[model samples]
Target: MALKPHRSPRRVNLISPADRIRPDAASVLLKMVEEPPPDLSFIMIAEDLDAILPTLRSRCVLLHARKPDPEAAASWLEAKGLKDFDEQLAEAGGNPLAVIRGHKIVPDEARALFLGLLKTGKRLDITKVAPGVGTGWKLDACADFFSRWGTDLIRVKSGLQPSYFVGETPELQSIAPGADLQRLFHWLDETESLKRASSVPLNNKLALEKILESYRSVFRS
Candidate 1:
């Protein structure tokens, strides 16, 4: 697509967030940034500067962004008239914008369902959780939840603090003892891959079933 023509004499600001631009898009953007029109300015934001293409990074000034403190982020959310600010802030990993926009998927129902699956251990019925594996943001969120659950299981096994579900230590402790680390790590890797592939059109139900079934295998009798 040709760059949208900007009328002369009017200042234009082009802002691109990190990870949203593919390599081809970055190439096109590089040309514009290299020889920007007199009235045009570009601002590119990235969570990891190193992840940005070297060609793109070379053409612009770099700025590092720091995540806000959880307490401060919670306070800001509360000031914005949001309830459960602390929980939201933690769910967002202290990202101020995520907290403000409330983009993180609410995991209450999913967590409850997952906890039941964990309680069943080796006999978990993947079919039960399969129906809840929705597409779009919900599927992405479900994959993330599993990843965090995997992390918490590892933490419990290794005698460390659980970052996601701190209140579920007892349950985590019970499950952690029989968790096969090799299988758990494999499942974690698979969840991450699914998360990255979420943008593409997928059979969300089948994908979710595969993930849950794999998760069921992580626990040994």
Candidate 2:
């Protein structure tokens, strides 16, 4: 496609060096970059600089893109007045992009699901699981929290302290009665496997229900 004509006096031509340019074509393109047409400029967009020819890099100006701050992001979210504030932030998994998108997912619902899982421990009942308890809503939350919870349960079984969860710390501490780490590990592995497999089946809801039930069995065992 021909480059869009910009209103600016300096012309900007966007090109990809990756394109298979004939030697003559490359010479011509290089000439354009070296000595741009009158009131014309060249802009090359590259996915990575390392891939570009040294000749091209020598003539181009490098610009660095900066990401937004998480603290500032959290503050912005707070100012927007989202209910279940902490849960929204936690669901973000420390990514500012996720925090910006937290409003799309129901924070209260996701939090309740996570908390419910923690509260039940080994005795958690899958049949009575609350809504939105299934689906791989937040892999980080499940993997990180549940994995740690399992470790804590193992620690508790050994007469040691099972530290707390970020929001569910108190609840975890309260329910810290002896845990079976080995069983917990097995359950986590099973749940993770099922969760991953949920993608294969079209009936995602049924798959999730089976996953929850499977988890319940692991806990019961």
Residue pairs with backbone overlap in model 1: none
Residues 1-221, model 2: lDDT tens digits: 24556576565666764332334555667767787767676667543365455676688788754544656667776777755555445444444555566443334665566567657766776555535555545543344445455555555556665443345555655555434456566866765554344334345445445555654554443
For model 2, the run of ten residues with the poorest summed lDDT: 195-204
RMSD of each: 4.0, 11.2
Q: Which predicted model would earn the best TM-score?
A: 1
Worst 10 residues of 1 by lDDT: 132-141
lDDT of 1 by residue, 1-221 (tens): 23554666546565555554656767887898788776566766765465467987887776677777767777777788888665555555567688676576545666677767866667889778767643343666677777887888898889887766666778888778888999999999998778767756778778877888888898887
Off by over 4 Å in 2: 1-86, 103-114, 130-165, 202-206, 217-221
Give the lDDT of residue 134 in candidate 2.
58
